[model samples]
Target chain A: MATFDLNDEGVVVIVGSGAGGGTVANELAQKGIKSVVLEAGPRFDSSDMVNDEWGAFQKLSWLDKRYSAGGWHGAVNHQNLPAWIVKGYGGSTVHWAGVALRFKEYEFKTRSTYGEIADANIEDWPVSLEEMTPYYEKAEIKMGVTGKTTGMPHLPWNNGFRVLAEGCRRTGRTDYDSGPMAINSIERDGRPACQQIGFCMQGCAIGAKWSTMVTELPQAEDTEYCEIRTGAMALKVEHDDSGKVTGVLYADAEGNQQLQKARVVCVAGNSIESPRLLLNSASAMFPDGLANSSGQVGKNYMVHTTGGVYAAMPEPVHMFRGTSVAGIVGDDVYHDPSRGFSGGFYLEFLSLGLPFMAAFMEPGNTGWGKSVAQGLEQYDHMSGVWVLGEDLAQDQNGVTLHDSEVDQYGLAVPVVAKTPHINDVNMTNYMFETSAQIYEAVGATDVYELPAYPASHNMGTNRMHAEASKGVVNAFGQSHDIANLFVSDGSQFTSSGACNPTLTIVALAIRQAEYIAQEMNAQNI
Target chain B: MNGRLSIDVYQAIADGVSAGADADEANATALKAGLGEVVAQAQALFGSSYVDIPDDDAREGILRTFQNEGFFQGVRWAAYFGIYNNPDVWLKFGYQGSSVEHGDYIDRGFSDITFVPEGPTLEERMAQVKG
Candidate 1:
């Protein structure tokens, strides 16, 4: 790994080394552009990855103190855990279940296509699917995503996914398959194929799944132009008088504050931390917060309306024997207003071990009680689908800094509140009914509808829009207020599509890198 | 860990709570604080110590009061991890842990995994339960 000097004012400082920041850094490095990547957590390679659920969770999950508020399940049952993101070098991509799907055309045109959704902060993305398709193709090939375009076969299904696939088949749904997964189906990209290890959420030990730790970060490092400094948590983005972000204030591994100078700053710290950093970076020039003139920096935060739908079959499913989410049911992924919701959802394969199933069945209740214990008694017979749906963005549902309460870092503790819109309710109810139908069609003994767990798909805080007043960034994730500043992550999403946002985030970062390099060449501030 | 329960049941709960104590100190503290709350609440509700309450339903009612508290959820998390993480409990639930070393469950035990073409009717399942 290369190291850049603290006073190196020529480097582009990219915060949060996840899919976005990592891809951007690597892409920029490929262009011979220098960058310093500041990652909040320690860098754990595949060798350090643990397979045990609890062990891996402690090792990878961002368990720092955060408060949840509002009428959602996270607030009621998981008040202290609003979202579950990784704080490591690769970020959530390390823990992600490699289910990659590109955004539909209408998904990018939410406001135009959905047409005046009530009480929703709906807006069309400035970039269309047409513009993003080429980048998505690049991302798919780069990440070894399994699909038609990538020319890579999808990974094999586990018994858990088999049950769901069989159910989908019995229900007359033909759009079901084993992939679009970024996890390798064959030995490619210097990484081995997935061995169906079941614990995909835990870091893949063989590096079969695409993570920046193995892919982008290493490529970036090999370029000798990108320095990924792990265990450096970004506190605030510092800017000069002209409102151009020039450096980053971060806590080093030893808990000492250090400022690394930069020519440009890209905030990719997910939806929560990205906005939280901006809100904390408030100055006299931008009194409310940096690039927050629209008052939307921390607003419209979305973790897709999600839940675990498990069915108890009469036979042992042994759902935890293969890749966690390679299988998906896409029959309900399109819009149909007759279904009483403007948007739709996808049912993807999910398997929770006994401990996790016991934890999330009804999170706030006692686990030893017969209610959940009985559910666990049939753990071997269970097959589940994780519903990722279109959760409407409401301005009130977002991340806000607590005035008095502070974290161990002495920064204000972020309070992430999410109130589900009625659209979410309607869509969720329909999702439940249709998902239950898929399971029941194949003779499921019982269908268990579990509420939302801590979100891994957190998105849409510093969104993109053409008008500066409507959003924080442009189509390219460039800050509307600050020319040199950018939001290069899922935080730049204008709408929360039903699909997983990693592919889009990676695609956006890849495209953003080109734009950034062009601006550097053009000598634009 | 509460003494209000009978010795046999109390031992099981105690074993679980003891196992749970190692999960995280925060969870253990929450559980201990909650037990303290339960003791006081039991006295207030029944004019007797929790152990001397002598009725399971009354004791359950007292415990239900703290269900929404952090301690309650913490205890739930601890107990589940404690109880479920136990290999014996896992065996009872027919769960196999950590599949990577076992050739990734590809060929072994991934085949002939049955799903009933048509499941047992409610009356049929009820008959099995009754039996």
Candidate 2:
């Protein structure tokens, strides 16, 4: 591991070594630019990963002090932990299920497509799908996403997916298949093929799934220009008198404070922490936050409108025998305003281990009793689908610093405030009913509707906009107020498209790297 | 009474909560420390004789009363990890433990579905959609 001096002011400092930060670090390193990646969690290799869900969760999940508010179920159920993002060297990419998807063209122009939704702050993305296509191709190829530029075949249909596919067939839905996933179906990129681990969310033990932990971070380290410092929690982004970010003040592993100087600073700490860090860095020059001239740093938070539906088959399905999310039914993933809702959703096959099934099968932790026990007893016969729908961005839903509570690092705890829009409720009801109907069409004995898990696909806090007054960052994720500061994570999402956000995050990072490199050569900072 | 739960008491609670599954056969020592904390909390809430209550209905009622409590959640979560993660319990539930360690079920049974209709091959589907 290469270590750089804290006074190295020429290096770029990237916070949170997840998808965006890790990819940006490697891409910059490949361009011969030195970077210092400060990750808030420990470094763990594939040898440190486990197949057990709770064990892996303890090893990877960000258990920091964060409060939840508003009327979202997570506020009451998962009050202390509103999101399921990781805080490790690779961040949540280590725990991702590898459902790689690109946003549709219509999804990019949501404000124009679904015009004037009540009480929503929707906007069109500054960058369109046409502009993002080449970057998406590069991201897909680099991540070895099956069924895309890699041309590797999609993973085989597991029994759980077969059950869902059969149900979709009976319901006359034609757009369902094993999804385009980043998990390897055939050995490529020097990684082994997925061995049907059934524990993709618990960190792919064999490296078949492409995570920045295994792919980008290690390759960045090999470049000798990139130094990844684990257990370095970024406290604030410090700026000079002229309002340009110059360095980051972070807490080391031993709770000692340190400052690492940088010419450019990129905030890639997911959505919540990215905004929280900016909010925490408030100074006299920038009273609102680092790049909060629009007061939109942490506004318009979104975790895809999500829920789960599990049905019991008469015969054994062994849903846990294969991948956690192997297939997707994209029939409903189009913008069909006729469905009594503006946005669309995807029904992806999901199979949780017994512990999570028992814990999260219902809301508020009341998933006990004889009925719940009976569901667990029929675990082998249960097949399920996770609903991923587009959540309209609303300015009221956001992350804010709490009034009194402070974390272990003495920073004000972030209170994630969110309330499901009526559109979200309507879409979730439609999804649940449609899923139940599909299962019933295939002779399912009983169906159980599971509430949304904690935010996994978190997005949109430091969103991109064409104008400086509308959002915190510009099209290329450069902060509108601070030229040298950037928001490189899902926080830069303009709209919460009805797809997994990791691929979009990677594509945007790749595109941003080129812009950053050009700006550096031109001495723009 | 150092407030530690005994093996027998843990077994009884495990059996009572396992919904008639053979939870007693699973190891309790691994969870002894955590369950002991739960037992201390339960004792503080329902008194020491709560574990010795004769009627199953009464015992279940007490457990249900503390359903949302931390002690109950702790006990239930610990029991779940202890009981469900056991190889014996996995066998009883027909779960094949950790298929990746042995090998993927690709050639064996991943696609040997009897109930579902076979979808078109990936290449065929891609052609139809892209074309």
Candidate 3:
């Protein structure tokens, strides 16, 4: 509730209050640094969440004007929606199923380990997994991840996960179980344990799941060091003569523009809007975009090589009875060039409800047939898994401001383009084959290899690297060109590992906050 | 429409096409503005008015041409969700909608799987792998 004046340049202005921005706000507030968090959507507490999938999607999803253009499945089937992230205060964290996974060591060092995957523009992360361990542990602890670090037991298996686990067992794959999740197994942080109510994607109605809405934002507000302005859509970041970001020009709730001055500006507007805002903020000093000296601001976009594999079992599975993402099968979550692909994938339990499956099936997006109806007829008998494979960075695949189109805010609309690499294609095929084998091994009546859905795990638009010449931001997510500006979201990802990204985004935000505080202490920016 | 239950017809077509609420806005706009042109195009393709199409197969063929059209996609998704998200349709799919009110499904068969065997615990699996 503490509000800062427009001329208060002492406070940092953080855009997009999701895992990254919200985490940075809380972490900085805890360090006694003040920040003004601007969320483009209205804030919602856990009680305001919806259990209906369509209802929550209508309420929380990012419905801004953007276009998808590429050869990928998303372009053909879902041309308007390349990335399906949330827009509310908690961002995608509100909608995320509590799958808290850490990147493997090799995942960070993909360039060295995978070594020349033809067209893949892979690079080693500036911060290695060894350096990130403590931060990862901190993030896990902060989110109350149910794993070895927290001493909280993994969530119990549901009928959907049991089907996949049995299939994994039958297929000789072992690293399968109800894995480390951020949802409460036993009430520890005042939030009740997950009651197995199942609508995790529809924003966790019971607050058992860790969302910045229920955790970071409220905590940051309580510290009296943060002022959160909901429905404040950032139009552009204005900079001083020295190329230092001085303030952000954003449209307030009433659609009138206001300038909130900043000591430092952090862009955590996920991948699309983060890059789009930077591009929109282009000036006479930085024509290409703010902090785009290397032309890497909106380059190398990667939405984890993803797909869904659902099987129609003989018996009823009732996949929607528990947590949405039930468990993970991580046998494939390692590097193996011998498999004709550079990186690996994980088969996580996924159970799409009747409405979703029917819709996404698109009747094959090819023919209007009875086949889809037959599949939906077996809704209770369905069990599924989502494939999260490592997607390589391609400079050709990124976000670009559309040539002539402007959105509701009158800013140029962002056009996200993706072209999967040969490695991605080969790896996806391997995923389908293996997933189909697993399902068929456990007596699946029919297996469906669905095309990729609108990506929820988007990364690498304002990527991190060791050197300024190679990337936009440094390891701390501080922009190389604009010292006072930072990228504190999955947008700064150097590479996309084959896992969920919220934990890593949180860990990086915490780490970046520490760096920002230290730099402030030293009067660096 | 094709001798199937009225609900099954929507499932056969598609749903979730209008995932974003903005898409719904655009779709609603297109539904009003583009319907006339779509009918005209359908008429030209079918050699008759859209409602006067003689056969389902011919009607489907004309529909295929406008598959990517804004009006077509909008109307289809709107119609599909109308039926599928309906409370009456929930019984057909055995969907237990919004269980938080009755409490979480922890005891109400969230873990119940009759066909699949109960697997070993995570500890047991780790121990076995170590061995």
Candidate 4:
């Protein structure tokens, strides 16, 4: 509820108040530093949250004009909407299933561990897992993730999860759990425990899920040092002649342009928009883009290699009766070159409403075949797993500004070009076969393989590298060229590890906040 | 209500398209208004009498003419949303609608398992994995 003046040059300006920007705002505010968070979407509290899937999607999804290219199925299927990210106050966190996971040590060093994958531009994270452990713990504690940090027990197994666990056991796979979820199994912080409404992705209507809209943004405002300006779309990061970011030029709620001066600018507008903003901010001093001295600003875009495997059991599984993604089998989430792929994946339990199942069970606009209809008819008897794995970053697969197309904001629409690598194809095949086998070992009558939905875990557009020539940002998410500019979102990911990116994004933001505070106190900028 | 496709026509299309779906179960008024614009555009593109074309094959042919158009996608999505979320449709498909508002079935049926187990319980499996 706090408000800051547009001319306030002393505040840190954080764009996109989601997992990253919202966390950064709260962390900085806790450090006695003032910040102004500019969220491009409207503010919606729990009152606005709904259990209806399509309704929540309309309220939360970023439906901005974007183009998709490259050989990825998304290009042909979801041509205009390549990513299923949110645009509102909490960003995608509003719609997240809250599977909080940390990248393994080997995952942090993908480039070093999985050496010389052809056509992949993989790189090791400048900061190792060892460096991120403390921050990850801090994030787990802060987000109330169900694990050792919090004494809260993991959620009880729903029927859907029971089916998945049974299948895993039959297949000789181990290492499955109901959590590490950010959703509350018991009430903690100021939020209530999850009612297991089975609508976690549709913006937890009861505030059981940790979202910046209900958590960080409010806590930051309680400090009276943070001002969250909703419906403010950041157009460009304005910089001075000396290459220091001065402020952000944004279009306000009424479509009027305004410049909010800042001592520091943190871009956390998810992966696509974070890089798109930089690409759009091309100036004489930095003609290529802001923080593009290495020409890696919008390169190496990665959404995890993903697909879905669902099986129709003879009995009523009622997969949609509990949490959407509470169970995960992590035995396959390790790197073993013997598997014919460099990286590995996790088979996480996932359930979709009948409408979404009908739409996304197959690709293209309309999934009207007999197989698709029968699959929808058997919704109650189905249990599924979403295959989430490490997606190798390729230099050619990235976000680029379209030449001719313009959005309603008069900016060139971002063209998200992505094509699955040979490794991705091989890995997906293995996952599909393994999943089908597991279900078959259990009592599955029919199995369905669904292609990847639009990019859910968008990462690696402004990646971190120890060497300035290899990446756009440094180990601390600070731009090498502009000391005061930072990429505090999933866009700063070096590699797409075989886990969900929210926990990592939050941990990195917490770490980045400490660095930014220390640097500002020392007047390093 | 968008002045192109009437509610009756939209309901008829919905009933005709969806197998075992009742026309009254769908949100006919809303779908008619929402999908009316798209239906108008389809009519404009294919022919003015596209909606009134009585023959099922001729209507299918007309709809196919605008397959790549946003109007067609809209009409299809409208039918999907209307038919899928209907309570009667859910009953027919054996889908127990939204459980969150009335508390989860955690205590009621979440732990009920009738199928024979191929391996140990999840806890035992976890213990074995840990070892």
Candidate 5:
């Protein structure tokens, strides 16, 4: 960890070290700009990746035993599973299952398609797919993503692509073309190519996948001007009378609060904490909170209402032999209103459930010792796919400060309130039917449908829109009210496009980093 | 006066409220009326000798209801092991032997044993249950 005097200046403070912050830090450091990235979690590497399920879950998760979704109201008392969102130096990219897809062109212009969803503050994104095309190219090549996908400006063509494309052709669904992913089939940077080990979600013990700890952050460290400080929690940005970022107030590991001066501050914590930090920084001048002049700091929360279908086969499928997700079926996403819904979905084969998780997910009839033993015997024969769908951007699904709940830092905990749109429900049911049909197509018997509530992706909180009233961030992901402050995570998504968000997230991060770098060089400050 | 069971009615009300019953606000008016009938019945049964009694049945009933309801079975195995394996808890509930003996208890459905280890904890050759 690097430490600097509070009086020092000319440093850019990036709040998170995840996909967005890590990318931004690397880009800035390469431009000969000094940066100080403050991450709340500890720094870890491939060696730190644990083998046991519980150990792996701890290394790669944020929500813990103590944290709850504000204890069951409109906020369901649900335990968020150990999803790909990582807590270490690499962020989520470390443990990601590594299936990435870009959003479709129409996902940008949602208001035009859905005709202004009821009670939703929907707006067309100021930037389009064309504008972000180059950044997407740079990110794909930099991260060494494999598989040829259609509807993108640049990428290689591969066997997975040919198979999925042929499958789509056979089904007569033109939209079923395979999209490019971030996982490496053949190595692209200095790292070795993937051996196709299925435990990519367990943090890739061998660094075949590109986590920031091995990729961008290491490069940023070599630059000498960048200071990476893990276990440092940034509380708020302190501004002078001119309203430009002067420094940041943060706490150390031992609960000691301190200040670090900076020329600029960019917050890149994921949708949950990024908005919470801004709301917690309330002052007399900004009663509602900093960078919240429109008072939409934590509004329009969207998590793709993720559900799935799991099936048992007669023989061992060896589901854990390759990547957690090898292929995707994206034919279902479109602007069609004839299906009596506003949104749609995509599908991909998911990893096999581990022993304990499989035992728990088994039906209620098989709960005792005999039943648990029987379920364990059928572990290898199971395989499934996720039904990743879009959630309507609604005002009702928002994050607010829970007055009664205080975290370990004495700050008010973020209370998330979610109410699924009727369209979301309809689209969810549609996806269940589609999943069953696809499973049947793939010759699956004894299939079961998973319910679609308590969505996992967790996106679209700090939405980007053309008008300041409609969103918290501008088209370039800059805070509309605070000139020097910016946001760069899934929070800036306008619509939850019916696909996994990492490819889009990485592309957006690259674009935003470029925008910031160009503006800094032009002396726009 | 007499050895009467101490019935903590307040505890029963609290338990009822926590279990999501209509005891607190929903039946407050009815409870106020029903107290008079119980008071008169108590006085008629043992005049000047009536004493407050603890309702051991309520405590036992709560435990039995939890067992019957099958709540927190699949979930919270951590809490289950915490109470289930503790020897003091087994002794209080009138069960015998160590955690290894739990299998036998499961089969018998009574969790009782004839002999307990004794005599200064010297147990290498103890033959208490051998006969």
Candidate 6:
């Protein structure tokens, strides 16, 4: 309701408030570095989270404003359509099912092992897992991630992990391990322990999940130095004659356009809108777009192509009893990598299909009178597992601004042309067979494999590289072309690991925040 | 004799044809006696605007005047009876009728939704249609 201004100490302005922006904001505020965050969604209190499905669906979820479009390639056309996207404080993390796992060490380098891909600009990352391990540790402690490491010989383990491991061992597949998750298993950080009501996709009513609404942004709010302006949609970044970022221009809640000056500007709009902002910031000096001299601003996107397997157990699993992701198995992750595939995959037994969504996918539903009743009867007996594998980097699957269409705010919408490589199919098939075996071992009847696709956990848009000619950002998540501009979301990922991207995004955001703070001190700005 | 010319023309010729007159020669003589004019009058009134025939609703309807009199229904019934005579029409509609639930759109990779072979005859389908 009020017009805003930058804090007096020339605060660093971050453009988003999800895991990446929230993580950096909390770290910056703790270090006594002045920072301000501009978020497009309103701030919601955890107390506002209601229990009923109807109330939760209407009040909390991001189902209304999401858009989709197909992408175009060098000489090919791609389909761009609309989809249900999230808005508000947490961004996609608001509706995320809360699966957390660290990226494997090998995920940082794809080109180094698999060789150059055809018609792709695939490359390795500047930072490795060892460099991010400490930050990952800090994020685990902060977010209260549950589960023991399962794939390798020795990793962290928890109760859920132990049960999955025992189940796997009983079936002669000794590779079942505990999965790491962001939900609060115990009463850590003043958040309540998990009651596991299984409605996390609709927003955790009990604050059991570590969403930004429960985690970092609140800490940022406590620090008076960080000012959070909600409903402030950043249009583009303004630059001075010297190619340095001057300030950002954004539209306010009242549809009034305003500019806020800051010493540095950080864009953390996740993978989709982050590149959209940069591509929109075309100027005389940077005609191809800001910080995009290498022509790699919105290239190298990955989604870890996923499919689901559903089986009917003898008894009702009541999968809605706990968090969405229960456990993971990587027995087939690296077992036969010498078979010529460049990557492995992980499968997690998870809760899927609410009443409405399940009814939509019901196999025997005739959409007539008595048939609808029969479909609802099978809801309790169904349980499913989601298989996520590494999508090798290919330049062909990239995002570009469309020539014709624009958003409601008169900004060009990004047309994403994504086509996963042949290796994606190989990894998906391998994971599918493993899932079928697990179902058979656990004595499941009536197993069905869901369709596969390049889904929405999009990563690696503003990728980080050691050389400026190759990547848009440096290892610290700072733009190599611009001194002060930084990116800390999944956009900075070099390669998508065989795991969910949220936990790793949090780790890298903290790692980058620390780097930014030290850089400010050194410059005495 | 005032405004009309009455010909004892077709009656005399038709009577002769019935009494062993050459039938083809009689037809040719009738055609020569202005039969084209009679057909031209019929075409001028009916042929040009068939699709726009008026119905009970103030707007032009899809069916012609004669079809609106129930001729189309008779033709449909004929087609349905034709299919009823041929049992293979059931398989033509892809209706195996084995565990096939009504309105089930998705097949579990087991069966496809296709035409029922030797299915309902056009006459039977038209009879089933309610007014």
* Number of backbone-clashing residue pairs for each candidate, in the order shown: 0, 0, 1, 1, 6, 41
Model 5 stretches with alpha carbons more than 4 Å out: A1-4, A64-84, A148-179, A359-377, A452-456, B1-71, B74-131
Structure candidate 3, residue pairs in collision: A359-B15
Query: What TM-score would you give candidate 3 relative to the actual structure?
Result: 0.90
lDDT of 5 at A11: 83
Estimate, for each residue in A381-485, the C-alpha lDDT of model 2 and write its tens digit. 889999989999998999999989999999999999889999999899999999999888877999999888989888999999999999999999999999999
Identify the runs in model 4 with alpha carbons over 4 angstroms from their true place. Answer: B1-11, B14-78, B116-131
* Candidate 1 TM-score versus the reference: 0.91
lDDT of 3 by residue, A1-525 (tens): 578899999999999899999999999999999999999999898887876878888898998888988788777677788878899889999999989999999989998898876777889999999999999999999999977788777878899899998888988887887868899978978889889998899898888999999999999999879999999999999998888899999999999999999999999999999999999999999999998999998999999987888998988888999999989999998887889888889999987776787777653345344456667777788899999899999978999999899999999999999998988889999999999899888899998877788889989999999989889999999999989999999999988999989999999999999999999999997
Off by over 4 Å in 3: A363-367, B1-75, B119-131
B1-131: candidate 3 lDDT, tens digit per residue: 11235755465444444354346686556765666675887767766787788776677676677776767765665666665676556766877777888888988999878788875565753443231
Collision pairs in model 5: B5-B53, B5-B54, B6-B53, B6-B54, B7-B53, B7-B54
Off by over 4 Å in 1: A366-368, B1-77, B116-131
lDDT of 6 by residue, A1-525 (tens): 122365333778889888888888888988877777888767776556543344554565434222343331211211232222356777667767677777777677777766766655668889888998888888877777764321111112322233334446656875554335677655667887665455566677678788887778878778766778888889999888988888888987777877878788889987777887899999999898889988889888777767776665544444434555656787656524565466778877665434322323322212212233233344445556788888766777667887887776778877666665777766667667767776656566656665442244778889999999888999988998899888888888888878888898889888888888888989933
* Each model's Cα RMSD: 6.9, 6.0, 4.7, 6.4, 15.7, 20.2
Docking quality tier of model 4: incorrect
Residue B84 local lDDT, model 1: 71
- TM-score to true structure, per model: 0.91, 0.90, 0.90, 0.89, 0.75, 0.72
List the candidate 2 regions with Cα displacement exceeding 4 Å: B1-66, B69-79, B85-88, B118-131
State in Å the error of residue A188, model 5.
Answer: 2.3
> Tens digits of per-residue lDDT for model 1 on A32-141?
99999999999889987776788888899898889999889778778888988898989999999898999899899989888897789999999999999999999999
Tens digit per residue, CA lDDT, model 4, A1-525:
578888989999999999999999999999989999999999888878776777778888999999889998888999898999998989999989999999999999998898988899999999998999999999998998876677667777777888888888878887888888998877899899877778888888788889988999999999979999999999999998888999999999999999999999999999999999999999999999999999999999999888999999988877787789969899998899889888889889998877678778887864653456667778878889999899999988999999998887889999999999999998999999988988888889999999999988999999999999999999999998899999999999999999999999999999999999999989996
Query: Chain B TM-score of all predictions, in order?
Result: 0.50, 0.47, 0.51, 0.41, 0.27, 0.24
lDDT of 2 by residue, B1-131 (tens): 01223475457556665543335433334345345654665577567665775665565665676677654665676566555555445655656666656666665566565777765675664554341
